[model samples]
Target: RHYGIVYDNLVAAMRAELPKTVRFVAGRVSAVEAGPERQRVSIIGQPDVTARLLVLATGMGDILRRDVGIERRFVHQRQSLTFGFNVRPAGASAFKHPALTYYGERVSDGIDYLNFFPAGGVTRANLFVFREHTDPWVKALRDRPRETLIETLPGLLKTFGDFEVIDRVSSWLTDITVAENCKRDGVVLIGDAYQTSCPAAGTGVSRLLTDVERLCMVHVPQWMASPGMAAAKIAAFYDDPMKQAMDERGLELANFRRSLTIDTDLRWRARRQVHFSRRRILHEIDKFSPSFAARLRGLKRPQVEAVT
Candidate 1:
């Protein structure tokens, strides 16, 4: 299934029902002042409303994080052109099975993982080429996105055969990548606000939603029931859970990033050792239960319950 299509359908469904139950507040949150019983959230437009609980889903904004003294580790520069192509099978040859191919060297090289998926009768492939954050090429063509796309597309075509470009996407400069220990007192950070991970791991959106759901379903309800739930209590409820989730994801992302992006020769050797060790661990797990590998494969299915 195309995620873009599914996302559009989901958005359409939400848009249809949004006006009925949810009130739309279209202004910026200027300030958040915590009090004894409720939080006084000051908005640019509305001034008279106060709530017992405040949920800020205001994604990865540096200004908001700075206000609460949360600093990030990895700088959130944009990932240069990761190209997607929709290819029609050439002549007598047909794609037998979909596969993800990882190519090139550890740190300085490009094309980390290229995924080929069945699209209708054709093949839709996405090529992820790693461009360094400090590269001069990225700096020169940063402002002109189309020029960057033009530069990256030819290389992708040469490596992966000729295919038509479907869509292109890039990350924002202001999008934050924070360290494991970045959390605040009064305000609760969820999603990308807490920590940003590399897209290579493919866990960012899932992790974010899981954090939100855990807080809303378990923690927030419990906090509401407490007799003396102050701002400190609310902060505590969010702190541990958010921190644990972010740390686990952050470590995984860092490992994955280091494996693909580190430029040092020594770091390459270290990553090779880590990769071999990880494979050995997997092999040992497979030996324990023959179906362990199969079950692990099944975990990638859409219906599988993700770890919170």
Candidate 2:
């Protein structure tokens, strides 16, 4: 199945299977008023509810975190537009065989990465184009999404040839950071609300799921056992397990970002040489043993994989 389809289906399934015992209140959580025995949660919708413990499931709301004195590191940039295309039979032939093709320097500023994956025993293919995060030219045309996409299409066509436009999507602005810690007393943040990393490293989604699973399965259960035990357990969970995961993933993302940036002429030459060297090695490896790459990736898997 396509990754996008799989992701959508998984989300839909989760939303469909609501617990009968657990009442889900859909609204914005404005405030959390703590009391002696329970906590009062202020909801923007009609009536509010009170609970023994409150779980703030807000995702990536930096404004609220800042109001509570939690300092974030990443900067939120403007949103970007994504364009997709259907591969024409003739155009698909160019990418029938597995190959890496460089689209060109992005109209935004830096170079954009384009990749094509062929469908097995078919004339259909999938193409992905990574745009620059913050490009001056792209930002200038942000208000005109269609014009922005039209302007960008030429750069893609110049490298990949003819194809039919399938769908155009727009993503919200997000922040990226390397800081690991995202927890505090009486309140915990999950998903983008806490910390964020570069998407290129593929850590954001996995890390967010890890946070949710860990909180719900381990920390929440212990907290529910007794109010006296809640504080210590929360502290331990955030300090040990959560902190370690974030630290490791954050370091990996930081290293990757550092490797991509060029400060000097010598550094630029070194980066280009390294990039070519890695490409050549990968090409040779794929030619000899196709499954070796998969095995290498599997070796890096965590001991426990969390369910999202």
Candidate 3:
């Protein structure tokens, strides 16, 4: 059983609704000053633009954060590596399922998971590995992806049917980080500009979406109505309850996923065994009797989990 979502089209659909006031600046920011009343933004090849408030949605690699005394504290220097490629059915037959997920079976494999799904008239394959970028296994996966993946995940071929690699593997090395001492005057940090998420955890977009909703839909309008854009006003957005909860959940999930995949301790090892055992038992029950499975769903366990 597997599930997946396509984000590229969703992004394109959202961009279609952008207001006319949203102008795209095509230049490097030479200087940024978070003034008490307004922000003085200077671009290398464009005229300076002053605004009552400035939001930094720049990525983790952005260096403009230094001017505002915001520094990234690396939580896990290199948390996970992600590989992306396109996969198509190898034979005349099509795959039974539109989307499929394959979780790593062994701790020693260092392979977290793999997802295959339909997107843009083709099937996309994404693999998440809890291994170093320079490791021999990582290099092997990059050079000979099909052969290496087949060897690593023997059940993959049987589960999803034969598939041919249709594109080059795109890889990403994620460094989990959180911004520190970012509370300043007029400028506010959001999305990857404030924190970097582990690709394996799948919390990156959730945190960023929360940031955008809390900042734009709620905080920004309220802040603009006030007299000055000072540190006091900026701190209010950081103290937002929804934003705080999402940030905490992202970090918690990062640790939980890493431990679930690689932790070989006694408790985690036992937990993993029980986790898969439960899923298997429920799946069996569903196959034999759907009504009986529905009865089990209401007993002590979550309806979704028991049914799943």
- lDDT of each model, Cα atoms only? 0.54, 0.50, 0.82
Per-residue lDDT of 1-308 in model 2, one digit per residue for the tens? 12333345676688779778768767777766543356567778767787765555456555555544467664433212233233443345563333334432432333233334433332232222234546565454445533443465556554455444333333433345423343444556666566554443446667777777787777778777766333445465566566567646654553443344322357755765675565567668877787995465345433222110
> Candidate 1: lDDT over CA atoms?
0.54
Better of 2 and 3 by TM-score: 3
Model 3: pairs clashing at backbone N, Cα or C within 3 Å: none
RMSD of each: 7.0, 6.3, 3.3
Worst 10 residues of 1 by lDDT: 299-308
lDDT accuracy of residue 200 in candidate 3: 74
Local error of candidate 3 at residue 286 (angstroms): 4.0
lDDT of 1 by residue, 168-281 (tens): 334333333653443333456676776665555566667677776778777778877865445566556446665475557654554554344544578667755665465567
Model 1 clash tally?
A: 0
Q: lDDT, candidate 2, residue 133?
A: 49
Off by over 4 Å in 3: 1-6, 21-31, 43-45, 288-308
Clashes of each: 0, 1, 0
